[model samples]
Target: MNNNSTGGLPVAETCNERITSPTSNLGPQFTLVVLVLLAILMVLLALITVFGNGLVILAFLVNKNLRHRSNYFFLNLAISDFLVGAFCIPLYIPYILTGKWIFGRLLCKLWLVVDYLMCTASAFNIVLISYDRFVSVTKAVTYRIQQGITSNTIARMVSVWVFAFLLYAPAIIIWEHVAGCSIVPDGECYVEFYYTWYFLLCASVFEFFIPCISVAYFNMHIYWDIKKRKRNRLRSTVSISKRVSVPSKGNGQPSRVSFLLKKEIPSLDLETEDGLSTSSRTQTPPQVMDCSHLSTTSGNDRSAALKVKTRSKLHKDKQIAKSLAIIVSVFAICWAPYSLLMILRAACHGECVYEFLYEITFWLLWLNSSVNPFLYPLCHVRFRKAFMKILCPKRLAVLPPSSQSSLREPN
Candidate 1:
């Protein structure tokens, strides 16, 4: 019996070593606590982003007033945020908490694919919004008449999904599993630094660099055009004023002015006097020289000027879309560090400088997921008004009380 027990001791020790080796001495208690706190933060951010973006989408769908080309793009963006929160955040929470992946190879591949695709789609959606804004503001009259939520917008959205799928395909095909200790014992999954790097590079180029450059270019052109238009308007006004103030040739009168101000000058009205009653031909005051008529003309001029100004404002809105593009660019910047770290880690074939940087980058990337909804409200008056209508029904009374209450309810 003693000899049998001695042999069993070696077998038990081997089992223990295999089970504990992966996570042995991984971190101190305080470090674990910090990680837990981070996990909580990620959860809260995900919730807020998901809910806020969902609200934006809901407002668009329910508000007939928001049924337009611009809102269509916003709908796509909101969908992307919803997918990230619903699918990616849940998978990631567990992974981050344990500092390892216990999900199966199939799940890992699937999650990675979805993550990349949704993120790519989201980035491209921003580009589309920027372009749409550019079109609307640059050509307000045409845009107001023609652009709306329609089959064309749906086709564009479909194309965005197709592009995202193509963008994310490589990650699933190329990634290989690495042996590591995960949250679950007896679980095996893959992790590699090269895959991370590849994701970062591709995402940065399409999502960050391209969008940023395009938005900036569009905004600069739009602003320049607006400035030129303002100058032209000023020149036109000066010309009109000069024409109005100039006195014409005289025969006891300014000849050129006589023809221009004929309706106002009493002597000029002599031709029509014989056709009218004596009371209708009463003498006019010099101080009131066609001022009523002039004011009416000026009012028309001002109305035309207002129309031009509204068109210019529409152009400025296109620049706002450019601003959204910049916001997407900022998201790429936030994500870049982690991606670079992952690539470096992979290149080294082990953890090195990337270890600390990776954690920081991870948090930053997570932050990007939470900020865009707030940005939309900040940059867009329409979105802000819509959001307000949805949030505070008393302010926008277009909707009935029941419908407004429903809108305010949590989803």
Candidate 2:
């Protein structure tokens, strides 16, 4: 459609108007002193995460007793933590110093991909652990009697990792890292989420909010189940003791002790002086009785042993559940800030309300990976023993140092 007849042909207006955003330039900004300190701290944390998780994995691998279907989740956790610390956290240092993501488009996408994927893995792993424990505690009686873990434990664990992957893979698959040098001298790469809002919403819900709520609910049920089992055990114990100690009147059954007493002790035949009765005078010499109570006492002993063994197993399972709770508690404390900020960022549609706040949360969330290794040994005696066997074998054979220190001054 050329308008050549008009002496002065009007030119088509080009759509070159720029759209501006207040936060377009807002990136990670930290003071020189703070940034240096933060970088050093992050370095240390990353090192700890790598090394600590390595030790955890090694300990699990080396110790045959630690090899259980549930502990496999910890191994998965170690790998996830290692990835977060090694790949995801190190990328932040450059961002903080330059106030821009300078790691290039490929790396920028990689960072976001690894960040969400592994973090989701970690979160959902905890959920898996909690649900597993809930199952264990709730089905304590059947579980102990069966003497085997349920068949679905492995399936549940696999499902957790799969869900984590599927939830965050879209973020990477739909990733459009727009790169431009004119945006800044150093160059800029952005994870554009405007077109992926629905994906982001679903990922956020499935990967975080729902999982957290479910974990908390499952842990509560586990706690109640443990308490209920404890009460039932106490009731059964009291009833057993009463049955053994109290005699049943007008019934055919006597008390356990009385039955044994009556069986073991025979009547003493006495001689009557000046009586001519042959039955009383030279009665059968007080015959030695065979141990008549042996069978009853042995049977009682076997039942007691069975009870003790069952109690020990339950106690061990409870301890394991408690140790897992400790891990989850620590994880919750460290991850809450990150998850909350992530929700805020998601709600804002990638328009974060504050600068540098998410970075702080990022640091907090990374702290969990570093802390998990230490929490295991501290909270669980089995892990403590395994660690000691791995690191301080000589010291483990020796008795632990007394809590009452002789070096302390008399108060």
Candidate 3:
């Protein structure tokens, strides 16, 4: 057996090196222990992925507030992850342990197609997620995304699934549709199709490389926009404070001229009993001015309300953008090594496809699928609250007020 490690896991294949076989070097006890550990890990991963993505979907179904235009992408992603957890990861365990595809020819081909389909769909969904966040962050000030999101949402979801299917179509075409080359040996159930090079190239390029570049580009733009918005807000606050702090000529009172310029002169600016201009009434205490009435001015109130609303919206959008950026980053990290290995395997032409390394990389990809649910709690208070409401309503009922603080959006 050859040696290759992915994510610190040793991958060894057995027998003729075509499929996995046990090592002669490691004793049976050690191998059994390893197998048991791998089984436990795989089962645990699959369970968490199913349960977590289920919660994400449940949150969407129940929480009307979360059923927004942007969140539709999340729903799509959850579905794809659920498929990965339920369909892809579990089938892998037996193959790895037994070193053969004992599941028969038809089922093996079916498994290969489903595995490729779900994994491709998951990748495409992430691309959609990045695109959605980028649009939200870039166009929030200009567009009522909510008004037009239905059409956009439908189009995106359809496109993601369709394109994902197309990306993996070559595999199905070569292994099943092509008449002469589609045959698998008797009792074998692996993905050792005829077009390994083309399959690996297409899979790596479309699923990994292109998506990685798109995610990085979109997130960079979103990040830059957030910084620009924060800078503008800081400048506005500083300008307001400076304007408010200006004192008239040697008196400790703030300038009436500045306040008048800002608020269009309150009713108190009218001629006093002494008939002096409002600015000349230095002896009058600034507190005497009816700032409350000025604050209530329709134009001023609207302006302040607009500023507050805009600030809050920007804050929320930025938080969401950051959360999605983390998700994208996690996806890249999890999938990169797998993509690399795919390229290597293609280059080696099946000579170096280590069972253990492939499994390690495969699990890493699933890790991304499983992590989405946990990320919601880490980045968004609303999702955390929604999750708790679904998972443990009784526990949340007696939840400490301080614990609610955990729901705050991360910095």
Candidate 1: residue 186 Cα off by (Å): 8.3
- Model 3 C-alpha RMSD vs. true structure (Å) is 10.2
Q: Report the Cα lDDT for residue 8, model 1.
A: 17
Candidate 3 C-alpha error for residue 212, in Å: 1.1
Tens-digit lDDT string for candidate 1 (1-411): 112211111233232232221222333423767877867887887898788888888888777766666777778878887788878887877665564567776787688788777777877776777677666545544555566448888888888888888865564544322222222234433322222354545556765568667766666666665566556545544544554565444334444543344333222111111122112353456565543234335534543553454344535544565675566567558756765665565444333563446656756765665676666644666666677877886776876667555444110
Q: What is the alpha-carbon lDDT for the whole of candidate 3?
A: 0.65
Q: Write down the TM-score of every candidate.
A: 0.68, 0.70, 0.74
Error of 1 at 410 (Å): 29
lDDT of 2: 0.58
lDDT of 2 by residue, 246-276 (tens): 4434454544555443332222111111111
By TM-score, the better pick of 2 and 3 is 3
lDDT of 1 at 375: 65
Query: Which portions of model 2 show Cα errors greater than 4 Å?
Result: 1-29, 140-157, 175-186, 194-199, 247-314, 349-352, 397-411
lDDT of 1 at 322: 60
Best by TM-score: 3
